[model samples]
Target: MLSMLRLTVITLLLAPQLAGAESLVSSLSDEAIEITSSFTGSRIVVFGVVRDEQETLDEAEYEIAIVVQGPESEIVARRKDRIFGLWINAASQPFFKVPSYYVVHMSENFSLVASEELVAQYKLGLANLNFVRSAYSPEARGFADAVIDIRRRENLFAERPAAVAFLAPNVFRTTFFLPAIVPVGTYRVSVFLFRQEKLLAAKTENLDIAKTGLSDNIARFARAQGALYGIMTVGLALFIGWFAGVIFRRS
Candidate 1:
């Protein structure tokens, strides 16, 4: 309750600065997602209304783009080179403040809706995402590409150019998917309104993905009592091994 109130206050405080453009209001279908053992994947619907105070936008003049971003974390990407019939890490780069998961949905192809500079400014697409490296290196770009490739293969980062659809006048929506292996953390949903390739307004919403039930308890225990948990894990492994050996011997 308090957090929601705080968010409302912050939005109100920021509204004055955004009054000249179309005002966007957006919310998620679900504010919190609970993951369980049977979890496969989840879908979230972003529903929003755009208000053009002057009523100036025409049917084909406006566009919408929505991006869902997971929590930022550090990621390291390495390059391998084969030497003497052995593969070893040759180059590495550390990326800071990279989204663990990212997906963007747009009313049309980003290139069709906005200029390359505008899209790059917003970092709306995977190729345009702002990845900060620990230090400059000649192979950093390749390492960045490797990071994106790995995440793409894992279904963590993706883009859909024409995913957002219009429901009625000044209303838009899009669906975003979270894989079963999604990291448990906070996520951000950003909505942008554009007209004739010009940015009009933007809005943001937050959602939380978390573990529940037995899984939540186990995670809490492991975090709160790491040493104890490690000891217990070792003991359990030894007992399981001995029990399996005894059963096989009897057989």
Candidate 2:
């Protein structure tokens, strides 16, 4: 009777932990996206489920964040300053390992999802992104913010709160749009699960964006034969201009 009693106590202690041992299983709508002339934009849905669900929890208590990030590149951010009442590019800063594209979809607001340290560690939002340089100065920060503002206006960087939708207690999904100007490379789709400011599970998936058909050929040819490509572009422009004039004259 004593051994059975001990076993019962241990089981009771472990029950809650076992029930809450949830992990994420997720997939992207498209693993590969091809960019063509008609490729204006695309939408990707991240479908996910919490596996090993032994217990049901309040949907309000469950937190999820999904991020889609494009390839990283080094960039120069130039800031314009008003000189004699005319704004001109005055200062420039270089940033390394900055994402070319980044977007976030959150189940809740930033403060409600997790602590500041965890959010910054996981880059759950635009403000938490770690875009930095060797010199951490106020001027550099201004440059970085300028660059981010430009990207945000262009739909390259974004954050959407309450974007994740829960179909069931353990099932959820999110969808985000990729603009027509999305860069061509391998992007990462990251899904994170949180509860009471603690991370429960995380998953990452890869997405490929590449130029297809004539677009690919033209890009490659332009890189390989720069002078020839420039001449061809000029000729095409002139031909289009003359063609338009002739049509208008006839009309």
Candidate 3:
């Protein structure tokens, strides 16, 4: 009878921790790549969400990161610049790092990337900026292809409630980017999740880099404007008569 009573007490004690595990879930809601045009180099923003399944916790804590990889020979033409009277060298060569994870890697592909685990007990919350890296290569002047691996950290309770817990499942969102270049085609973006240094899940998506949309429109407009200016030399007039006419229309 005493053993059965102890068993019942233990079950009740472990109930909440187990319940907490069941309720804790994380995910990425907005997962995609954003492309923009620039004269010097390309820029892209990768955004997503880390949601908790159970509402019990005040907030779910996790980290988001990306593993970026691209062509190797493309990295060249490195330069140095002076900042605040100090000589600082900079590179057009591309590399990847996570500020929060404190992990850095350089590779032609996303194979050598690593994640910096956060200190146990603390949780990384929403709006947490994980990683950002930009590279400019001579070959990339025409086009370049790269991959991104997004990861999230999960928390799990340990046997001893006071003891540090283990990491649960890591959610991932991977994708690829291809800057404008010759012979565009569909590119594959792969994503994976790891738990305890082992991959647990994987997913892939395809990105098309065809010449259409705002980038093309803006390029066409710029060319047309430049040509018009060269041929006609038109300029905006600062005439009081025109200004008065515009104000009169609003009244």
Candidate 4:
């Protein structure tokens, strides 16, 4: 309740600034996400407002796309082949600049209404994402398909059409879920405004997903001192084994 009130107030205060051009502005419900031991999942709400010169245009005349994207990574997709009745990796394709998580929400049915060329130009879908090493073999549904399928099944990527709901004439909002396994990194939330299927204005905001509490300290240490972490793990294992042997011998 409070968050919505705050958003509404902020939007009202910022409306005067967006009057000159086809202005687009947006905000996130939470700028930062903290991952703790008990964090199961979280929801992200994106609030936006589109302003234009025309006063009588209905909300239906505008097409809005809200995208939440996580950090970039290089992913490898491997194909398994049966060799002597054993499944093993036979071929692999590397995907560069892959987002750890990605989801797009649209105000209308963009897939049916928008042209392929326009969609590609805007990079609205997973298929339109920039790929450096693309094994785009449609017949085999190769690496691109494999990567998309895996991410979708894991709830790391999605495409939602007609998901943006209007709050007022120019005010709108969209929501997306972050799974328990959401990657910890800086994310980008982008809101795009379109009219007659043409992009007019765009806005972006940053979101940080991070570990907290004892878990955060451990993760920081592990990442900063990988060799020391490995050595400590081996030492702990040895100590545990020795202690177990001594207890068994006494028994």
For each candidate in turn, the TM-score is 0.81, 0.78, 0.25, 0.80
Instruction: Tell me how far the alpha carbon of residue 216 in candidate 1 is from the true structure, in angstroms, after superposition.
Output: 3.9
Candidate 1 least-lDDT 10 residues: 1-10
Q: Candidate 4, which segments miss by more than 4 Å at Cα?
A: 1-21, 28-30, 52-60, 109-112, 136-141, 234-251
Q: Which lDDT value does model 3 have at 189? A: 28
Give the per-residue lDDT digits (tens) of candidate 3, residues 90-142. Answer: 54434333221111111112222223333111111111222221324444322
Over 4 Å off, model 2 = 1-20, 53-60, 84-86, 109-113, 132-135, 231-251
TM-score of 4: 0.80
Candidate 4's error at 70, in angstroms?
1.1
lDDT of 4 at 66: 77
List, residue by residue over 93-187, the lDDT tens digit for candidate 2: 88888898999988854346467788778867777667843447888888888878999998999888878877866567777777778889999
RMSD value for candidate 2: 12.2
lDDT against the true structure, per candidate, is 0.73, 0.73, 0.29, 0.73
- C-alpha RMSD for every candidate: 5.9, 12.2, 18.0, 4.6
**TM-score: the better of candidates 3 and 4:** 4
Per-residue error for 234 in candidate 3, Å, reads 32
